[model samples]
Target: MLPEAKPGPARRLVDAIRYGNSVVLTLLAMLCALLVGAIMIVIADPPTRSAMGYFFSSPWDTFTRGWHAISAGYVALFEGSVFNPDSLYSNGHTPIFGPISNTLLNAAPLILGGLAVGVAFRAGLFNIGVQGQLIMGAICAGYVGFAFRLPPLLHLLAALLAGVIGGAVWGGIAGWLKARTGAHEVISTIMMNYLALGLLNYLLGISGFQAPGSNQAISRSVHGTARLPHLLGPNLSLHLGIVIALLAALGCWWLLTRSTLGFSLRAVGANPSAARTAGMKIERSYVVVMLISGGLAGLVGCSQILGTNHALTGDIDAGFGFDAITVALLGQASPRGTIFAGLLFGAFRAGGVVMVANTGIPADVVLVIEAVIVLFLAAPALIRAIFRLRESRGGGVGVGQLAKGWNA
Candidate 1:
């Protein structure tokens, strides 16, 4: 018998993608994004560009300068996000945990926002109103934080509760609309975001919410008693918001994996018609899940107002709600995955600042890297094709399936 023909490179590549490992694909995607970022860094560095002009005359110089530029930018990123031994003694002081502190501080709100989206995802809902929910929460929390005169602990608790309630109410509106009117959540939530923005702007211009005699659309500072306390020393900006975020993640994990409500929600997500046939309350689940989702998002507002900003502004959400969508997607709609994804983005944020200062690279480079990462992750097929990864044998959960649960 004739020997079997061997597979060509193209056939092998296609077969590899058909059986690719998701974890490997994700890592490879990140590496590719960084490689693209490194190319941008080299192009943007003046010395590196100049060295390249003399490549024929001095190839070694060009390569050395290019490597140095890339190394410096990445080193600064690490020092800014994680740690820097060189900072052990600056101005005759002890080592400051500024880098890690900044990373945590930046991550806290992201974690909450991501959990909000993740919870909604697990319940067969697409919550695009995280920005609106967060804004409303901030408005309510900021009002309570400044207008009230309760004692320290009471004031903080009241403010936090107010924020949670505000977000829940806003989210519930969309759920109600979907249940009662059969309206699409994606459309309703988007409209609510605009409404929330307008409401914030209006509130900031009012007497009670605006800072005393301030012309800008900024709310009064939250009372000191209501603000989240610093987790480390006064020198560090890190606060108890990180603790709250952690607890929220833990709660989400328990709720999804160990609770009856979680089972009901997951069942509904898996098949609404079947769940309804089995006597599950579909409308109630929608409303309840959205309420929970919005409440978690409200925690983001509290972290901003009570921990980081201490004041409410029209831009209080700072695009975090939208970013949370990316986070939820990257995390595969899992609570544990969301936590790690939030930290990764937080590191990007904290490190980007230092990278800019140290390497003179444009801040846009970081944004590009982030966008590229999301693009690759969202299109796992592209990752598989690029890396020539082998496909697995059995059917598995896919990103498209995760995203298209409700709509698809």
Candidate 2:
């Protein structure tokens, strides 16, 4: 019997719109997650709910007062992290610039970190040790930034180069072990975490490497010549490093979608045996992909050292490398998507300080909210079932949608 006619282009497009459950489903999950988070926040801190109600009841009376307390508490973290906003002492309005600048400032590292994780996911490699890679990168950057004396721009570039080299070496180790000895990349990367952390602690404790008379296990601040300059006004926290992060994201996107190397990596990731049949070197691809992933992670350290901290400390990262997973997933593994997701995450993190200072809610509540959101995003089927929605083209539901939506 003759085959039935295939659907037309318009019909296929319509079907995809109706059944392609990736972006819409993921967004729905996010909305539901936010609703749940809001409820949790209200439950965790009743006083904030009461204040919210009071502010809602009266537009002008307590609205801005509540907002200021929430957003500008503890001398405005936004100002401290990003460019210092000029305090405009208006009658009622708080400085709105605080969160805006800080959001961009903090988003810089997330962009690169997200890129690292996102690119690997495309190649079917789950690199869980980006945190370790970033730590190693930071150490490398710190060592070069402080110890080396170079020309104006070269000094800064040298530090960044050190970060890339360190991160690449660590990532390459994981790849090499996986290829040569058949070790799982995930396990190897996880082990690398301890290696990175332990080595950093040892190095930071040494007199020559440690900050002078600080009594803390932190590296000395980079020299003035190596520091990333503020893109914003003088003395502002905003720096040119953010620009570099954005540019790097663009570069990664191009490399993944436009380059032959990226194609090989993606092919091997999709099916190693098939790729091998097609004349691709699966082992070589593994090593190359892992090294590139590590390099991207290392850039996070460069941004942290050059733009934000300018000094290396044990707490410099504060789980940002781990958090990049969320950012990458949220962005659906696209470079541009990662930037947007990073901004969203950065906003939540930046605002947490405000929430803590203004309300009775602990900043930990934000962490809880973030975790819940990630959980829901990770398993979209639960969200779909909870919402009682029909299944989309992606059979596994929203989590699958998140996985499929990278190229979507």
Model 1's alpha-carbon lDDT is 0.87
Query: For residues 201-242, could you state the per-residue lDDT of candidate 2 as single tens digits?
Result: 888899989999988888898998888898766544668867
Q: Please list the residue runs of candidate 2 whose C-alpha ends up more than 4 Å from where it truly belongs after superposition.
A: 1-20, 46-96, 393-408
Cα lDDT of candidate 2 equals 0.76
Error of 2 at 368 (Å): 2.3
Q: Model 1 segments beyond 4 Å from truth?
A: 1-20, 91-95, 404-408
Model 1: pairs clashing at backbone N, Cα or C within 3 Å: 16-389, 16-390, 18-391, 19-390, 19-391, 19-392, 20-390, 20-391
Model 2: how large is the Cα RMSD against the reference? Answer: 5.7
The alpha-carbon deviation from the true structure for residue 323 of candidate 2, after best TM-score superposition, in angstroms, is 0.4
For residues 78-109, write the lDDT of model 1, one tens digit per residue: 88899977776686363468889999998888
